[model samples]
Target: MTLPFFVYGTLRPGETNHDRFLRGRTSSEEPGRLTGSVLYDGPGYPYAVDEPGGVVHGELVTARPGDYRELLAVLDRLEEYAPGDARNLYERVERGVVRARDGLVMQAWVYVAAPPAAARLRAGGRRIEGGDWRIRS
Candidate 1:
């Protein structure tokens, strides 16, 4: 699916990977939130873990038409993701991300913590309260 992506960590604006990866590849970036998940701090990034009654703030990024496939491949590589891979740290899933502007729920690609990481984070990872990685303190 060539849906837009919901990014909450390093891939978000002003973050290190944003410019390196999405700067010119995107058509737009707008505030959004993924429900039923919480943000957890990773080594240098952040992971969104599935959880009840949770929401993670982020941006919904639409890729430029021509860069879709290339951007998708690059992001898969960057996220260390491979479809059906058992060792993946993150699993890209299609989820409803509510746009902050109009409260519109749009289906977008969300990279959530894979099984191993999700279990660990759910058990006792450092949660980013309020779900906004940008203002985490």
Candidate 2:
């Protein structure tokens, strides 16, 4: 089955990793938002964690069925997510994403900071109140 992924960091379009990873592989892409999440600066990258009143701006990408498995593997490695690993940096989960251009809502895979990782980032990482990693202030 084709899978949609919500990316809020380097993986987003025009970002450093976009060309290397998603550029021509995705079948469709659109601006989207995930509610109840906050974006944080993870030094060179950004991380997203659950926050009751937060909204994270990102993009929703649809991967063709032929590319789904390989695409996910690459993303997993980039995010340092290892299945069954207790110390994973991010935990991949399915969540609802709202397309920014329209009101359409769809379930997509999202990588969120794990509990311990989130706590650490909350204590040290700078929070991007606007929830957009592309914006710099």
Candidate 3:
């Protein structure tokens, strides 16, 4: 089965990690938004956290069945997420993503900061008010 992924940071098209991981592996892609989340600068990267009135601009990508597992594995490694690992940098979870063009909403995998991580990022990371990583200040 194909799987959808909501990517707000490096994995979006034209971003550094996109070509490395998803260039030709995805079946489709479109601009998308993740509501109720905030984006924060993580220096070279960015991180998203759950918030009440936040919206993060991103892209939704569909990975073919044959590429799903491998793609997920690579993403997991890149995000430093190992199932059940206490030190994981990000927690991958399924969340709703709204397509920018048509307003179509769908569930997709998203990486979010855990509570502690969120707190730390909030304390030190610059909030990207527009929620687009490419427009970082």
Q: Which candidate is the best by lDDT?
A: 1
| Residue lDDT tens for model 3, 15-41 | 999999998789998999999999998
Collision pairs in model 2:
none
Q: Write the per-residue lDDT of candidate 1 for residues 55-114, one digit (tens) a residue.
A: 999999999999999999999999999999999999999999999999999999999999
For model 2, where is the 10-residue window of minimal lDDT? Answer: 1-10
CA-lDDT, candidates in order: 0.95, 0.90, 0.89
Q: Candidate 2: which stretches are off by over 4 Å?
A: none
Residue 66 displacement (Å), model 2: 0.8
- The digit string of per-residue lDDT tens for model 2 on 1-137 reads 35599999898898999999998789998999999999988878888999998999999999876888999999999999998799998999899899988778989999999889899988887898899999945
Clashing pairs in 1: none
Better of 1 and 3 by lDDT: 1
> Each prediction's TM-score against the native?
0.98, 0.94, 0.94
